[model samples]
Target: MERIKLHIAYDGTNFAGYQVQHNQRTVQLVVERALSKMHRQEMKVYTSGRTDSGVHANDQVLHFNSPMTLDCSSWRNALQTLLPKDVKIMHVEKVDESFDARKSAKEKVYRYQIINQREYDVFKRLYEWHVIKPLSMERMRSAAKLIEGTHDFTAFSASKSNVKGDKKRTIKSIDIWEEGDGRIIFEVRGNGFLTHMVRIIVGTLVEIGLGKKDETCITQALETLNRQVLGLTAPSHGLCLWKVIY
Candidate 1:
């Protein structure tokens, strides 16, 4: 058997999530179904990470083992014929059998985009969060730095996450940049992330950007692990799985 790695991208608007699930349509399910059709056997695929429903991916990585050997470039074309238009195989290649998409991944990067203006654009409705508030970009930058290192990020995670083991995670960087036309983007890179971590982080920083929360609020919220202190969790559609590092 040969292990194959696939570079995948999909619009997560219609699908449930990345992982395989019962009955519901998903990114992994569609890819695996297409592979099974081509290989003439059931194929199991593993992704670098999971994005919640309504989320999106720019270049998500997945790995699987298959006995069928085909040209890497042609593999994408073949799979595209079987998969939906929204879920396409950007690229594919053979990797060392030891490479597991999830386990071998070194880190991940995500981007949360918000369109801060008087009115939301209908075209980009599914891609960006619309915030109707005047924001202070300088204040948002100051709050972003507090999350640059390893910390017990209990305050920034989903209350319903139910993630077992350690809640501590190392955030390599969190940067906020302004784009013209009232758009602000939060680019975050981290070794790992908890469920809704990026959404909460974005929401909190937005509060700071609006001058609603001071620097002291971040430290106080972290110490108390209170979810109420942060702003509302932004919609999942605004978040995208930008890239996965191996």
Candidate 2:
């Protein structure tokens, strides 16, 4: 059998999440079902990571072994025919068996989008967070700068996260910018992230931008490792797993 790697993009509005759950629709379940039909047997796909429900993905990666010798283009076309409209097979290729999507990943980039305006657009309501109050971009950027580099991100992670070993992760960079349409974007690149870490960081930055919290709160939270020291967790719909670098 040869390992096949696939680049997938999906709209996460309807699915429960990336992983399979009993009686719940998921990206993995759908993809694996299509693969199983193609192989005439059960098929399991390993992903780079999981995204929460309502969180989209631009280039989520996964891998599975198959005995079929179909070419890359044929595999893509066959899978696309079986998958739903919300999920697309961006690319497909054969890979060395040594490459495991999750363990081989070097970095991940997540983007959080917010529409800061009094009136929200119906089309973007499901994709972007709608915040009526004007946000201070300068304040948010200042707080984001403090979040760069390596630090224990316990305060930014979800309290219910199942990770028990280590909370420390390295953040390569955090970029906050604004568009003319009153849209604020937060793009963060990191070695890895704990569950809801990016969402919590965005929430804290939003609070800082709205003058609800001071920038120093980031420093204090990192030092204290207290979840209460940070702001609320941002909604999952606003965040997307943008890319994964191997």
Candidate 3:
């Protein structure tokens, strides 16, 4: 059997989440169902990580061992034919047996989008969070700076996270910028992220931008490792798994 790697992108609006559930439609379920059809048996697929419901992905990676000897292009074509329109296989290739989708990943980048305007656009409602109050971009940037570098992100993670190890993670960078059309973007690159960590960080930054919190809030949360010290968790729809660096 040869190990095959796939680069995937999907619109996460309709699915329950990326992982398979007993009664819910999911990205993993569809992909695995398509593969089972192609291979004439059940096929187990592995992914880099799971994204929550309504969280889109621009470059998600996965791998599976297949006994069929189809070439990369043929595998891509066959899989694309079986998968739904919302999920697209962007690239495919044969990979070394040592390669693991999750374990081999070096870093991940997540982006959160916000429509910071008085009026929200109907078409972009599913993809962007709408905030009516004016946000101070300067304040957000200042808070973001405090978030960069290594820290124990326990305060930012979800209270119900299944993570068993320590919550220390290295954040490579955090970039906050505004587009001319009143769109604000928060892009964070890190070695790894705990569940809901990015969303909480974005929420806290938004609170700082709105003058509800100050930049010292981040420092205090990190030092205290207290979840209650942070702001709300941003909605999952506005967050996307932007990229995975191998």
Candidate 4:
């Protein structure tokens, strides 16, 4: 059997999420179904990670083993024909048989977009969080700088994440920038992330920008390991899995 790596991108507006669930449409289900149809048997695909419903992906990675011998171009064309219009196969290539998408991942970058305006755009509603109130970028940027480097991120993780042992993760950097159109983007890169970690961080940063909390709150939260003091878990639609590094 040959192991193939797939680079996929999808508009996650309609699907439940990345993983499969009984009777629920999912990115994995569609990808596997397409592969199975070509193989004439059940086929399974393993992804680098999961993205919640309404969250999009620009460069998600997955892997599958196929007994049938096919070139990369042929496999890409076949899968593209089967997948829904919202999802696209970016690339397909042969990889080492020992490689596993999730385990082989080195880092991932996630972006949370916010529209700091009173009015919302119909086209961007599915991809951005609309905030009517003005936000202080200086406060948000200062708070973001505090979260860099390795730390126990339990305070930023979802309460129901069930992460065991040490909850330490290394955040390489975070960049906060605003577009001319009044759209703000928070991009975070990390070696790993707990469930809802990036969203919670963004929420807290937004609160800081609103003057509800100070930049020192980030230091206090990390030092105290306090989830109670953390800000909201920003809506899933505002966030996207921007890229996965190997």
In candidate 3, where is summed lDDT lowest over 10 consecutive residues?
A: 173-182
Give lDDT tens digits, candidate 4, residues 1-246: 999999999989999999998999999999999999998999999999998888899889999998989888998998899989989999898999778999999999999999999899999899999989999999899889999999999899988886688899999999999887889999999999998899999999999999988878788889998998878989999999999999
* Model 3 Cα lDDT, one tens digit per residue, 1-246: 999999999999999999999999999999999999998999999999999999999999999999999999999999999999999999998999999999999999999999999999899999999988999999999889988999999999999999889889999999988887899999999999999999999999999999998889899999999999889999999999998999
lDDT of 2 by residue, 127-179 (tens): 89999999999999989999999999998898899989888999999999887
> How much lDDT does each candidate structure score?
0.88, 0.95, 0.94, 0.92
Model 4 superposed RMSD (Cα): 1.1
Q: Compute each candidate's TM-score over C-alphas.
A: 0.96, 0.99, 0.98, 0.97
Worst 10 residues of 2 by lDDT: 176-185
- Where model 2 places Cα greater than 4 Å from the true spot, the runs are none
Could you arrange the candidates by TM-score from highest to lowest? Answer: 2, 3, 4, 1
Whose lDDT is greatest here? 2
55 Cα displacement, candidate 1 (Å): 0.6
| Cα error of candidate 1 at position 68, Å | 0.2
Q: How would you encode candidate 1's per-residue C-alpha lDDT over 1-246 as one tens digit per residue?
A: 788889988999999988778999999899989999998999889888888988999999999888877888778789899999999788888999889998998989999999999999999999999999888888888888877898888888888897788988999999888888888889999999999999988988888888888766777767887877777787999999999998
Better of 2 and 4 by lDDT: 2
